[model samples]
Target chain A: QQQVKQSPQSLIVQKGGISIINCAYENTAFDYFPWYQQFPGKGPALLIAIRPDVSEKKEGRFTISFNKSAKQFSLHIMDSQPGDSATYFCAASMSAGHNFNKFYFGSGTKLNVKP
Target chain B: DAGVTQSPTHLIKTRGQQVTLRCSPKSGHDTVSWYQQALGQGPQFIFQYYEEEERQRGNFPDRFSGHQFPNYSSELNVNALLLGDSALYLCASTPDEGFGGYTFGSGTRLTVV
Candidate 1:
């Protein structure tokens, strides 16, 4: 089962536009949600993460909006730039015992920003 | 300090052969996990090691196995390799304490012919 599901397999946006990717999870036990950005030939790098306790967390141009009641979350990039073009993955994890460290990742979204 | 380190960035092997991939966790980290990523697909967990023991595993078959040493470095051994086994193998590390995400290595690309 795909515990985490992401939408918009690929996206193209004009420079300075807002890029949005959405994801949802089925497991209510998930308490930690994180987004990762990956460039070609490299490992996925953590972008921003939010816990169920908060509705939104932002850092620089990247923001993660989470809804625990809905088991949904999204990553919004404001003023998108060419440098932001890359594959984005959304992941969910549980912090309890036994499975405290494993992450369930979504398929991924390939974003391309045109200047 | 060095991040997670993986050896032999790339490898090629024949079907039915056995291959071993290695990983060294980030300095001071005691837990290591392996993931497999196929082309155009997200990573799939293989297994995790802690305290020189296999603590958790994914849905992979028995042909996929691993071991962890006292130093926390780990090795993934795949026996009877198949063409479907070709993928990028990634190793991630995290400290046992605190609630933080894992740090991943560049990964070892394995091609099975």
Candidate 2:
């Protein structure tokens, strides 16, 4: 079973435009939701993360809006730039003891920002 | 400080052969985890190691084995490689305190013919 589901397998946006990607999860045990940005031939880099306690968290132009009751979360990138073109993955994990932070990741959303 | 480092960024093996991949965790990190990522897909957790022992594992076959050293580095071993085993293997590391996001390596691409 896919623990975390992401939508819009691919996305294209104009530079300076807002880009959004959505994700949903079924596991209520998940407490930490994080987003990763991966460039080709490179490792996935941590972009932004949020906890269930907070409905929203923003870092620079990246924002994560999380809804615990709905079991859904979304990433919003303001002023998308061509350099932001990469694959984005949403992951959910429980941070409790001995969990080893095993992450359940979404398939990923390929984002392209045309300049 | 160096991030997670994986060795021999690429490899190719024949079916029925065995392969081993290595990873060095980030400085000050004591936990390591392994993941397999198929082309155009998200990474799937393989297992995790802490204190040089396997702590948690995902739903992978017994052919996928791993070891963590006292220095906190780790190795993943696969026996009798199959075509389906061709994928990018990633190593992630974090402190044992929890909630610290993982730092991933560039990954080693394995191709099995």
Candidate 3:
């Protein structure tokens, strides 16, 4: 079963507009939620992360709005640009003693920013 | 300061053959985990190693095994490759099981024929 589920398998946004991607999880044990940006032929890079204790986190133009009670989280990009076109994946991880950091990733969202 | 590094950027093997992939964790990291990503699909966890021991594993078959060295590097071995085994293998590292601090390598693409 997919522990985490993401919506909008693909999205296209106009430049200078706002782009959003959403993800939901069923496992309550997950405490850390992170967003990764991946370009073609490259590894996924950490974009932003948020803990369950926080309702929201923003780094530069990237923001993660998390709803702990709803078991959902969403990433928002402000003033989206063509450079933001790439695949975005949302992942969740929990610390469980020795096995502490196994991450469950979402199916992934392909974002396209049209200039 | 180097990030996770994976060897054999690309490989091709026969269906009956066995393949081994290597990974070197970033400096100061001690945990290594392996993941398999199929085309257009998210990565699936294979297993994780810490302190040169297999600590946790995902729901993969016995054919998928891994080893961790004292140097904090790791290797993933897959036996009897199948066409479905063709995918991008990723190696990730973290200092410990914390809330964050995970890093990933570019990945090695494996093609099974």
Candidate 4:
């Protein structure tokens, strides 16, 4: 079973527009949700992360809106720029175990911001 | 501080051959994690290493083995490589016992022919 599911494998948005990518997960034990951004020829980097307690978190132009009960989360890039064009991934993790790691990830959303 | 670093930006290997990829953790980091990303796909967790031991592993098979050095650096070794083994191998570094986000390496692009 795909624990995490993301919509719109690819997306296109105008520069300065709002680029929204949504994801849903099946595991309620997951309390931490993080979003990652990847540019061409680079590894994915953690853009921002949020715990389930908060409804939303904003860091610069990137925002993560999480709905724990709904088991869904979304990333919104406000004032999207061509530089923001990259692949985005949503991941879930339970703060358990001595290992201290998370599990499950969305297929990833490729965002293209046209200038 | 210097970020995570990986070796061999690209590599080509024949099927049935073995290959090894290396990673150096970021300054001050004590944990290392490895992921596999196929073209046009999200990265898949292979395993994580801490305290020179394998702390956790993903759905990857035994063919995918790893070792962590005392310096927090790590190595990923794949045996009897198959076509499916070709992918971008990434290494992530983070503080051993913190909630900090991981810093990623540039990744080694592996092509199993």
Each candidate structure's count of clashing pairs: 0, 0, 0, 0
- Interface DockQ per candidate: 0.76, 0.87, 0.70, 0.67
C-alpha lDDT score of every prediction, in listed order: 0.92, 0.95, 0.92, 0.90
TM-score of each: 0.98, 0.98, 0.97, 0.97
**Model 2 regions lying over 4 Å from their true place:** A97-100
Question: What local lDDT score does residue B104 receive in model 4, on the 0 to 100 scale?
Answer: 90
TM-score of chain A of 4: 0.95
Task: Give the DockQ-based CAPRI class for model 1.
Answer: medium
- Clashes by residue pair, model 3: none
TM-score of 2: 0.98
C-alpha lDDT of residue A35 in model 2: 99
Native contacts present in candidate 4, fraction: 0.64
When summed lDDT is taken over every stretch of 10 residues in candidate 1 chain A, the lowest stretch is A92-101
Query: Model 1 misses residue B93 by how many Å?
Result: 0.3
Residue clash pairs of candidate 2? none
- Could you give the DockQ of candidate 1? 0.76
Name the candidate that leads on DockQ.
2
Model 4 misplaced regions, further than 4 Å: none
Over B23-97, each residue of candidate 1 has an lDDT whose tens digit, in order, gives: 999999999999999988888899899899999888999999999999999999999999999999999999988
Alpha-carbon RMSD, each predicted model: 0.9, 0.8, 1.1, 1.1
- Per-residue lDDT of candidate 2, residues B52-71 (tens digit): 88999999999999999989
Off by over 4 Å in 1: none
